[model samples]
Target: MRQALVVRGGWDGHQPVEATDLFLPFLKDHDFEVRVTDSPSVYADPAVMGGVDLILQCMTMSTITAEEVAGLVAAVEAGTGLAGWHGGICDAYRASADYLQLVGGQFAAHASRYAPGERSGEQADNYVPHRIEITAGDHEITRGIADFELETEQYWVLTDDYNEVLATTTTATRSWGAWQRPVTCPAVWTRQWGAGRVFVATPGHRVEVLQDLNVRTIVERGLLWAAR
Candidate 1:
């Protein structure tokens, strides 16, 4: 059986645990023996990481030690699949440039309204409904998916040209930043790191966002496609 690892824990606002829980059963249903952890120490274990076939990380905005980062990069390069959604994967380990480069993109800014108790200013009032376009319809990750609408944070990610974009969202009328014209940003993408496959989706700011049928389907397919 394939071994999968789920490491979750970061900003409570992202509900990493709850978000990961939603997909745990799905992974199991796919015949994977899933292991769960709340610590990054597991990444430092070469033996443990060497055995993992897939890694679903939900650690948002956290710091990772050099040892942990080294182990993770090595594992992925050796062919372990890496997949995650929202800030959990892409927005994590901001201090580590190596981690960002591996993931293909970073959470530069979120165009969403600030929640209660969050700093309420003009800068935080950009949440609005948006549509995700299925760009690479022939790709396995988005093969049968269609364009879908959602009311969630439209991530303004800073991405690299290495990504194979599967889906995208437009930022033409966003009120948060200074960009006046519409810019198409990647919503879903896949890339290769050494021998491993990396998959990412920029949605899922909340559990409900993941619960959306189309979002769930895309994510599920992305995970399975990325797995070795």
Candidate 2:
């Protein structure tokens, strides 16, 4: 059986528990021997990671030691698939450049949705309307999915050209924002690192976003696509 590891923790605002919970049954149904943990340190355990076939992580704004990062990267390079969504994967390990390089993208900020007269933005301000456009419908993970819209956290991510961008979302200039031009960022992307594959989705700030038909379907397919 293929082994699947889910490491989830960090800011509860992202709803890590309930979010990862949504996918547990899917993983089990696929014949994966699943293991769940609350820490990324588990990556450092060779006895555990060496035999793992896939790693699905959701911990955001957390830190990983050099040893742990090294182990995680090594496992991926050796063909272990890595997959995640939203801040859990992209916004995670802000302090680890190695981790950022592995994922091929970093969470920059959400387009601030300001109130009628409010100068400072609130948490809810990050919840803005956006659309995810399928850029590569022929790709295995996104072949049947169409472009979709969502009123959730629209991530403005810093991404490199290394990713096989499957989908994207464009952010328009908001009155309360400082930037003047419209921006387009990857909403779903896959990267190949050595023998391993990496998948990331910029949506899923809350559990509801993950529950979206298009979002959920793509993420589900991405897991299988990334697995070794």
Best by lDDT: 2
Cα deviation of 102 in candidate 1 (Å)?
0.6
Clashing pairs in 1: none
lDDT string, candidate 1, 62-162, tens digits: 98999999899999999999999999999999999989999999988765554444656643255558899998999987888889998878887989999
**Model 2, range 1-228, lDDT digits (tens) per residue?**
899999999999999999999998999999999999999999999899989999999999999999999999999999999999999999999999999999999999886677457635556867788789999999989998888889988999999999999999999997767889999999999999999999999889889989999999999999999999
Full-model lDDT for every candidate: 0.89, 0.92
User: Over the full model, what C-alpha lDDT does candidate 2 score relative to the true structure?
Assistant: 0.92
lDDT of 1 at 5: 97
Give the least accurate 10-residue stretch of model 1, judged by summed lDDT. Answer: 115-124
Off by over 4 Å in 2: 115-122
